[model samples]
Target: MISQATIDTVFETARVEEVIGDFVHLKRAGSNFKGLSPFSDERSPSFMVSPAKGIWKDFSSGKGGNSVAFLMEHSHFTYPEAIRFLAKKYNIEIEETEQSDEDKLNTDVRESMYLVSEFAKKYFHDILLNSEEGKAIGLSYFKERGFTSDTIKKFSLGYSPETWDAFTKEALGKGYKMEFLESTGLTIAREDRPFDRFKSRVMFPIQSMSGRVLGFGGRILTNDKKSAKYLNSPESDIYHKSKVLYGIFQAKQSIAKLNNCFLVEGYTDVIQFNQAGIENVVASSGTALTPDQIRLINRLTKNITVLFDGDAAGLRASVRGIDLILEEGMNVKVCAFPDGEDPDSFARKTSYDDLVAYLDTNAKDFIQFKASLLMNDAKNDPVKKADLIRDMVTSISKIPDRIQREIYIQECSRIMDISEQVLTSTLAQLVQKDITEVGKKVKQDQKAFEVVKNESPVQGAKVDVLYRLERKIIEILLLYGNKTEEFEDVFLKTNEDGEIENVIERKEYKVYQRVYLSLQEDEVELANPLFRDIFNDLIQYFLQNENLEIEKYLMHLNSDFAQEVTDILMEDERVVLHNWEGQNIIPKTKSETIGQYVSETILTMRWYLVDKIIDELKNSVSNEPGSDNTESMSMAMDYYKLINSFSKKLGRVMSRYS
Candidate 1:
């Protein structure tokens, strides 16, 4: 864990513009900056940033937050990765909090392995571009493969020298620890000797989503019969082959923008497609496609186009894994090149326009592609045809959307001449069989789903209302909590004549004090979990701590919570800065009449909760034993009267002249 003090320093020192400006092209839009959303394809700008508030909002995507949140969303970085990135950007020294011994060791080991991997990527890439042997062997191989110098450099293509311990000796000479070198599989350590794992091979660095080199795929240049044609880094703490895709680092942005992914089967396929100007492509690296890898793409886009060789046998084998994609509720299509060519060779030979047009025209939805390819031999064989239809229905059942499954079933009916009723019956049977196999677990899930399906809209609206009210409480505390101001407290007392009346008295209190004491008097607690957590933290800070700085307060919070707080603090500013900055838009500010604003907000919240309690009492009083309990009815009437009193108080507090 990063120490709180260090996190505070980093947040304070890192400028939101300077950090995000590196990734997004921000243009001046009144008091804020506007840009196209990085998360979606857009013609006009919907992404807004307010420098004054140190926050941003992507209107197109409904994602808004502080600087770290931007990095986390755009780059797929974890919380620690995002913080460390900001810390590095602002030149802040990191201070780690105390951890368990085991945790410390594990963290250190992964960091070390990552460091070694990064070092090896740079070293091999430098050798490929600069060294004599590397240029003659590795650079020549890439150039011969129709890769431009820019493409080679862009992908960080490299060459490991063809000698034992060549990379190991240099890494050690540079003070790189032997433990990390061997752990990352850059250097294989033996009892008698150490050797480079990728000697005499064209090196392709496999990077994490944030572009950190995790491992390598090395292709041998020579025809050494005993040596494997291609080798990969052995699995280690930092690299898990099943969970990552090649070229994801370079392809993520394009994949998101285009809303589709082209999954290929080799490193050269990815590289060549990117060079041919279609950058949203990756490779399975000849392994069976894993759910983890599909999920990696799922983070960016829901559409996948699996590119394959034209060989029918290869397509048949590969189409089986397309079910995993459908199981994830993703749309899938299959595209293959002409006979005797893969993505690499075809892309290497075709023009960019031709390559794109071919993909656009040849791409077929997975079901259509599967049925067409398999229906050939089954046309004359009735039993095989029945089995094929069942197989198609199985794939259809993997689709989570009922409408999509039905649409594909219709398409299959047209292609295979099978009736929709038959196909639908088959799918139901498969689904029921799955439920039977899952047994108790699925029954519980079905019950949960039914509960969700049965929830009323009014109940949902009440939850939304409560959510907004809780957010408002946090907004008040964060903005005006420490400021002392005049407040009017209304007391309802019975007069000497036994008539109800309101006595208004003026007093001075800090905003936090007024809100906290009011809630305390009413015995009210926030319902939403995040808002509740922030409320308690604000209470402790305002009541106990002396120094009150909003930036420091924001900096000390967890990033996820900080984004939520930043949203609450800046939601109004987003509108003010974007549309009303110079239009004489004099929206209400907490700084003016802060006391009444706080009182009204708190009263409004209490009024709703009181009203809710009255409704619940109505239910309780109308149900169960007595069915006409006077005491419950009296309590309900009292709450109803309280709501009326709250209504009058809110009206008085809200009227500016009062």
Candidate 2:
């Protein structure tokens, strides 16, 4: 229910590239931007952003849309939340109408989960402050751990009363669905009985990157040998433990600001770091680091410092995570506290400057760190030495970037006192073995999925050219929809014998109109639900504001589309050359080269379309000759006209771009 005026203002002021750049590390790739897919685990970048179009496409995932789409995919923001985020980012005020009871009832399932999670978080917070048992147990536990009131509230620390069914009864009394409670793992159900899952436990709300409570991690206060020290919410609709990190939402901005991240092993480690004035730190919640979790950190920063405990067992257990971090093309270093000290204890025991200095002095690149740690055990033992080398090579093989892999190999060889060639050969064999295994997996999947339609022609090639082009065009409109560009509109002219008048001179080239008209002949339908929704919304926007800037239109888009629009407008990585007072960057030779390529590709695609239609007509005529020949011939003429019109439009676009 945000006011249209506010939306318009946000769209006009908020740049898509600037918005998306906050989340995506975009690199310039020709006229667009590229980044690793946020939606999928990808080594190479398949997430593309066209700054010119203001849209992004995750080629790996077959998901394409504008900036709002990117936000929805990356952060899982609801349509309204996305717009509100953009509004806040751009300093635009939101005017929302109160939702009616009927409107509230029409919420989608995903939104319902979000609502339930939010309610649970509030309920937990209220209980922690208002309930006698909660205040004594959860609040006291956090205070003992040196958590200030602000920090406790910031992390949404809470407690469930010792009494069974306390939270469950309250939630059900408030009219929240029991099914969602069970699904969210907030309430456990056994036969005809149900009770609060976190009863008598200090609660730690697990959150998604956008700060939605997905699940909880709870600790038992009693020293019962039979009881597990900590318990986590069972995997639910919103919580996927392997795919989420503990402190991402809170630490993301600081991580980006510092251009580095500290990866710790536990929730308290993260909280302690943040409290101790080191905000760019997160933890895996004591779980082994996953590619998904690693990628999450990678999205925030390129540099990672794994904070390990000094104990040999702790360091050994963390080695696997370091290897995984390196394999993701990240700059990884390792740091260990003094014996008996973990990240939490160390951060609390020392001053910020002391911890910073210690990290700076002790942090070592993964290769040197790993080699030194392993070398100590392999002293004078050839068999152990060989095993260490093989292990190092295997870790090196996991790296996706050839340059990074080679650099690590050189370091490994130098540190391990081995020949570079020997290490290189071993690495190659490991990589080959991995590739073969992957190939085998692919073949097995193919056999299993034989009945499924193979949408990808080459498993990675563009599946639908028309869809791609249309999406690209929409992307451009979303990003640059308001830019004024000259365009020609043809009108017929006739003589004075009551036939027709001379063609009028018009100076109208509304960007939206041009985009609309450009695709009119193609009759392309946007396949993505989000894109389609935005497209229809955009058409309305255009009708209202002939002079609207693409930026201005962005505010009016649904929140999901707003995020996509913002991402597209803000995701471009083209570095504008500064202090170019006298430099002539547009060299004639370079311009000519680009022009030639554009012209050729446009004509090639157009001709391909034309020839395809012609071939289809000929085949149709041959296959059904009995149908009225004149009608068939007329239909063929219409097809020819359609292709001819598209050819002209393509030529125009080519000439304009050139």
lDDT of all predictions: 0.83, 0.74
Error of 2 at 296 (Å): 1.4
- By lDDT, who's the top model here? 1
Which candidate achieves the best TM-score against the true structure?
A: 2
Taking every candidate in turn, the Cα RMSD to the unseen true structure, in Å, is 8.7, 7.5
Question: 1-658 in candidate 2: lDDT tens per residue?
Answer: 6666765566566665667777766766656667767776666676677676555666667666655555677778776667777887777778877788987877667666777788888888888888887888888888899999999888988887888898889888988898888888888898989988888888788887767778888899999888788899888667899988898878877887788999998899999999999999888998889988988988767799999998988899889887788777788889888889988998888999998899999999887888878988999999999999998888888777899899988898888889999999988888898899999999999877874656534533232564454455555555446655554455778777768753645455555666666456556455667666777777787677755454445534555676665544443332221212236453232223332333334344454455556666666674465665566567777866756665565655322110
Off by over 4 Å in 2: 1-22, 26-36, 40-67, 78-105, 439-544, 549-658
TM-score of 1: 0.71
For model 2, what is the error of residue 11's alpha carbon versus the real structure, in angstroms, after optimal superposition? 5.7
